[model samples]
Target: MSQLANDSRVQVRKKSKERSKFFWGMVYLAPALILMSVFIFYPVLKTIYYSFYYTNNRGIPVTFAGLDNFINLFTSESFLISMRGTFLYVLYTVPLGVVIALFLAVISSEKIRAIGIFRVIFSSTMGVSVAAGSMMFLFLFHPTIGFLNHIIGLVGISPIHWLTDPKWALISIAATSIWMGIGFNYIILLSGLQNIPEDMYEAAKIDGAGYFTRLFKITIPLVSPTLFFVIIVTVIHSFQSFGQIDILTQGGPAESTNLIVYSIYQNAFIHTKYGLASAQAIILFVIILIITIIQFKVGEKKVHYQ
Candidate 1:
């Protein structure tokens, strides 16, 4: 009877221990879970709800308008322009960022001396905030007092309006975005490059393969997984670009540089058209989701884990 009683006590103790562990685990995760629910999930659902209601003057009425907000978004010209500019921005930024990052990664992975210093210099831009970097680039390309204009003057060329000119404004913004993004992508790609085995390169060299040939055939394929990640992230960032447009151009010069996110901000906060803005935001979200899904679907087929 004593032995049986002891076995029951042991089972009770084991159950109590498990309960304690489970309780502590819940305690540890509670704060993060609550935050996610409050901020992320709640806001998303609230936005969708708000998208169906219209507000008039005096801020009192919020009548349900069903799909009117969505229909308005489809018919809006400003939204269309913003979407076009956003598409162009991403089209340029993603490919440029990936290529430049890969180039920097390859250079940094070389056997040359001072690689650490180069890495630090390249990655330092990542520490700078987007607004600050945009402002700095704005000054650098400023038409009259800008350093770049001075260099052009020395070469007997006229100073080009970097921010004010509609033709060059988006291009300038894209260049700055590429410069700012290169550092982070370089670090990621460099880490991936470091993980590659040196034996593969050695074997390629023994087979009389030159540097460029081996790089094309082996290095690129091996690093494709990292490249795919960089491409997706860069594309997303480009789609969400607003700060550069806000600070550098303010969507001026005929709204040539206004992106979708900036236009949404203008509608919600600036224009006080909450319902319409919410609909626009939902559309943007759906577009991003579709693009990201497509990227993963296509990338998985091309990515080589080995």
Candidate 2:
């Protein structure tokens, strides 16, 4: 009876300690929880609530909309255009930006003379704000007196309408986004490359492996983790591209560059279709979530951690 009582008391004490630890943990987490509740959770819940209802011009929910908002979004020509444009934009930006950045990373990792100068030059675009970069590219893409047009003109070609033409407008925006993103990508990839041990390369050389062989076998596999991170970030960034689109094209030359986020902005703020905008926002969230899940499931298999 005495031993049983002692064991029971010990169990109680353990439970008490656990409860105390849990209480302190909650205390420590209170600020973050409160901020997340107010900022992230509340907004997300509000957006989801708004998505299923019709809203007045003042942004108050007026009536239950059921699936009407999503139905209209799928059927609407403008929304479809925005969807297509966004996907195309993602496709154009993610691959090319990563490739260019990777190439720059590889070259800049070399121990050549004045490589620091080259590194600075290569990664300089990261310092430019999106709006500023867009404005700079705006001048560059101008048909009348642009540097690009001037170069083409010297080569006996007529000046092409870069921003005005529907065919080239998206491409031009993709180019600008790629350039703006390269500095960040380059830095990340360079850091990844620098993390690789030089001894691995030396061993490969001793084993009669050529430069390309070592690069393919050693450099790329080690860098896969960084490359994966860059790809994910770039995809998300491309999907959410807004500043450059707003500054450069305003989703125009007939809504050719009407990305989903900008489309959401247009519907919500500009047109006062709050419910529709909320629905679009939800769709964007779902799309991103699905893509991220898919990437982790499929891509993480190839990520090698050293």
lDDT of 1 by residue, 154-227 (tens): 99999999888988888888998998888899899998898889999999999999999988998889999988
Compared with the true structure, the alpha-carbon lDDT of candidate 1 equals 0.87
In candidate 2, stretches whose alpha carbon ends up further than 4 angstroms from where it belongs are none
Q: List the residue pairs that clash in candidate 1.
A: none
Over 144-250, each residue of candidate 2 has an lDDT whose tens digit, in order, gives 98999999999899999999999999999999999999999999999999999999999999999998898889999999999999999999989999999999899
Worst 10 residues of 1 by lDDT: 53-62
Instruction: State model 2's lDDT.
Output: 0.96
Q: What is the C-alpha lDDT of each candidate?
A: 0.87, 0.96
Q: Which ten contiguous residues of candidate 2 have the minimum total lDDT?
A: 244-253
